[model samples]
Target chain A: MRTAIIGAGQAGRRTAELLRGLDAEREILLLGEETEPPYDRPPLSKEVLLGEERPRGLMQRAAEVYEAQRIALRLGEKVTRIDLGAARLETAAGECIAYDSLVIATGARARGLRIPGADDPRVLTLRSIADARALRARLRTGLRLVVAGAGLIGLEVAAAAIQLGCAVTVLEMGERAMARCVPEAVSARIEAWHRAAGVVLEFGCPLTAIRPQPDAIHLVTGKGEVSADLLLVAVGAIPNMELALDAGIAVDDGILTDADGRTSHPHVFAAGEVARIWQRGAGRHVRFETWQVAQHQPVAVANALCGEQKPYAELPWHWTDQYGRNVQILGTHSAALEWLEREDGGRLIYFGVDPEERVHSAVLIDNGREATPLRRIIAAEKPIQRNRLLDPSVALRQLC
Target chain B: MAWHDVAPEGEFEMDVPKVVQVGEDRVAVFRLADGFYAISDVCTHEYALLSDGFCEEGKIECPLHQACFDIRSGKALDEPAEVDLAIYPTRIDGGVVQFQL
Candidate 1:
């Protein structure tokens, strides 16, 4: 059995490692576009950007792990085309590798800035190691920074910059920051946290243009003109589904996959941010762009390969460390849900309850303790009364 | 030290685990279909209280990351958690639960 995994990321590397253990005789090839080993992407905007940790610290496994596993790792190589009919992959180096099974974990790329002056040297995006290195070089104390988005990446960078004594300003087109991922009250708490840490947030403002000056960047917004030493664009990411679409695989907002990560084509599987997985409980399809989802999805894919049909269903959880704060989110909450807050010391627990009074999702800021019970409550669909949830005097265990 | 004075013979439910703090030790007391058992309330993976976790069958699921542990032996079920929780001796005495610290 020959297996070829595209994009040497967390999902792809995990799949190759599992396959090697399952069938040692089976040939496995892991192709990575990056020259380095597979590394964690979360720290790029935090530790790496702040220069607190080196870029090499992000590597998921040591070099010996790949060598000992007897997995073929192709670095600095790009897969140009996937011949689904021929069961082969064409590489940029002019190598055709035949495979019995192919896994597409191509992942997603940072959405590039399209406005004028986006090509300037001061304009940056934090997605890969190279981007982090470049951003770190320019991140000096007392420098002014203009961040174009208030999403996770942007907020993380802003927080790091503020800690470094940089005057940071964040511009968000939405009325509230992280509007897509978090509820309004939760966003308000985060907004207040950032503001207290010396971050200037300008909401409901869109940048019209970016003009590069000799010493600063002049950003024209609907509110007013702002000058900064650097500009960071972190609006969002676009799924890399071109190869899947060109290969005749069904593509919606992302490459459509069943519960087991099986694509429309046999012997072809898709995982990570590029695949739109079917959420069994929700009875709908969703695309998750987080490290936790990426780590858990490969298990279903590997199980499917071994002839075991297992549905992929894990409550989505993500964590972010910014400005000495640990923020964790679990499950998904709608706009109609009510918010309940419990504050203990520096920690804040925000619970979102549905119309049936069931805990739908939760957000924890500096509170790993509260996150424990909240995770299970969300998973069990436990109905937590709003008043009781907001009361800090009552133990969370008693509520359960 | 009498069995009848510790706890009611069948007051504990199979589904909900009761939390009991004996001296300085926090214990989670559960009554399964087979018998009653007691384990430390703290999760081996994190500082989570095991009594707050959901109880199903004979296993207590850690609420933090959903790591399951056997109530009888107090052994961790899977990855992300590789340590076993502490088990305590328990008995029923006069309609009350008496756990040996």
Candidate 2:
């Protein structure tokens, strides 16, 4: 049987790994748009942006591992078309490949600033390794950086830039940082962390235009004009679902998939940021562009492809590092969440509860040890006992 | 390698990892439901005191990046950290916790 995975990101790499494990002799082809092999994206802002490390360490495995496993990695090959009926894919290189099972893991693409001069060469986004390589070259001590958003990527890049001795300023359209992802309370706290570290955050402001100059880049904002040596548009990311949509596969916010990652077309599946798996807790299909979900969803997809069925119901979680504190979000992060903050000695844990106290999520900052058990509670959606969850004397594992 | 006594058994709390200086190395000694195991006190992802990190279910999540490490085996459990921690041979002698450096 031949299984073809399109994308070559974490999801594609994971699907290839699982397929090899399930059947040693199955033919597998992994296609990626970028020339580079599958590498981790989380460190692009942290390690590679800071010029502290190259992306080599973030690779799924050494290049030789692919040959050893008999997995063909067709790098720099973008799958331009997918014919679900024929179970075939056409690449940019004008090569057509047929497969018994196909996975659309095309991941996400960075959202661009559609304002005037937005296409200027000085303006960049932090999505691909190429972007990171160029950004790293231009970033130096005394370089002024104006980030367009205070979301995860923007704030992370701001922190990394500050560490590299660059003058950093972050602009956000929302009233607080990560407003869509975390509760207001969490946003305000993290905002303080950013400001305290000498990073300037201008909230309620959005970039209107970017004008390139010989010496500096001029950015027009709601407040006034600002000139900086570098500009990064980190508004957010949109799922790359065009290939699936063009091929007549279902798509909502992302490519629609059943619990087992089976798309609308039989013999075709989806995973990672590109797949909107059915979420039981939310009672709707939702897509999460998180590192944790991208690393895990392939297991269920591979199981179903191999005739071993298992629903994809893993509780979503992802962690981010900023300045010196490590913040972990378990289950979900939503604006509608009501959090109950607990202080155990010096550690802080926020439990996201609904009106009836049904636990929905939890954010643990500088206390990731609480994550493992907290994940179990969030996955079960158990009723919250405020006192028990608040008491650090009581281990979170025992509470569940 | 030589074993050096760091702390008494009573000094450690159940499931709470403590960082103890053993000559030139800082080690995090964990007291689990079973016994004790030791790993490097430094997080491989970044420079952070692993003593201040969270420990549960025989794993320590780095306070800076949340990179988890299995205390028993010292294997890195997730992203942002791919390097396995250096786990030292540990044993308790006469109510004292000791680790081989």
Candidate 3:
């Protein structure tokens, strides 16, 4: 079989490796748009921003690994279009590659700012190794950094800049930081930590425009106008679904796929940030943008190729390390539910319940100790008493 | 055979692990439904103390990175942990817990 995998990120690399391992006789081609090899994206806002590690350190596999696996890696090549009827992919370099099976892992790109001076040289977005390198080169002490959006990436960049003695300010239009992933209490804790680390937070504020100045950029916001040496826009990301949409495949927020990573079209599959998978537990189609999901979904896709249909239904878990603190979040938290906090204040486990107070999901903060046990409890659907659940004297194991 | 008493069994009702000094090594004693088991307190993966972790069934979960280990066999359960812990014989006579190292 001739297989062509697009994107060359974690999901693309995993699919290529699995295809090579499953069928040695098959010809595999891994195409990446970036000039460099596959590198970890999570570190772009952390280690790369802090200047603690280089972009080369984040490569998933060395060059020799691809050579030894006999996988043809085509770098700096962009796929212009997918010829679905002919079963071929046309590249920008005017090369057409025939493939029996194709994996679409085009991933996502940062949402660009659309203000007046959006294209100014001082405005930046962190998505690839090149973006990180460019941002790092411009970072200097006493430089003012205005970070739009207080999401994970924005907060991380703010923290790193503050640590490097830069005057950093974060602007979030939302009521609280990390509003999508964490509870308000957890957000409050993180906000406090960031304040202690010298990051100025501008919540409930929106950026109206950016005007380039002689030495700095002027940010026009609802609160006030601010000047900064660099402007970082980390609002969110948009999935790269143009190719998939053009190919007439289903796309809602992302490319819609079954649990086995199979798209609507036979012989075409999707994974990574670009794939919107049917989440059985959540009973909805959800898209995940985490390294764990990218690493895990390829196995299911490979199994599906072998005639075994297995759905990917693992609990969504992710961790972020910022300002010397390890923050981990598991499951999902709803604001309507009651909060049960541990006595030590080090752990906060939010319980999601229905009208009858039946536990549906749990969101734990900084308490990896209870993660495995909580997973089992969530699976068992055991009824837990409200008072007993909040008792710090009682071990979490006893609740099980 | 010298059996030094470490902690009372009731102390483990709230949490399984109770750190105790046995000879020169610091050991963590866990109380499960079956019985009490003791192992080295320090995590083989990092400098985290095993006694501060969450215990469920027969496994001790690392508080730092969530690496789980079987309390009896001292074998690591998953990734991020490549080394196994050293297990020591533990027993409970009456209400007192003792370790045989």
Number of the predicted model whose TM-score against the real structure is largest: 2
Candidates ranked, most accurate by DockQ first = 2, 3, 1
Error of 3 at A297 (Å): 1.9
Top candidate when judged by lDDT against the true structure:
2
Docking class of 2: acceptable
TM-score winner between 1 and 3, please give it. Answer: 3
Per-candidate local distance difference test: 0.81, 0.84, 0.81
> Tens digit of lDDT per residue, candidate 1, span B14-93?
65777766566677788888777888888875456777566766887765545679999999885335578898777766
lDDT of 1 at B87: 82
Of the pair 1 and 2, which is ahead by lDDT? 2
lDDT of 2 by residue, A114-187 (tens): 89998888888989888888888988999999999999999999998989999999999889988776778789
- For residue A197, model 2's alpha carbon misses the true position, in angstroms, by 2.5
Per-residue CA lDDT of candidate 2, range B11-34, in tens?
988867777786778998888888
Q: Comparing 1 and 2 by TM-score, which wins?
A: 2
- Model 3 chain A weakest lDDT span, ten residues long: A52-61
Predicted candidate 3 versus true structure: per-residue lDDT over A3-84, tens digit per residue? 8888998888888887777878878889999988777687788778778555332545676789899989889999999989
lDDT score for residue A46 of model 3: 74
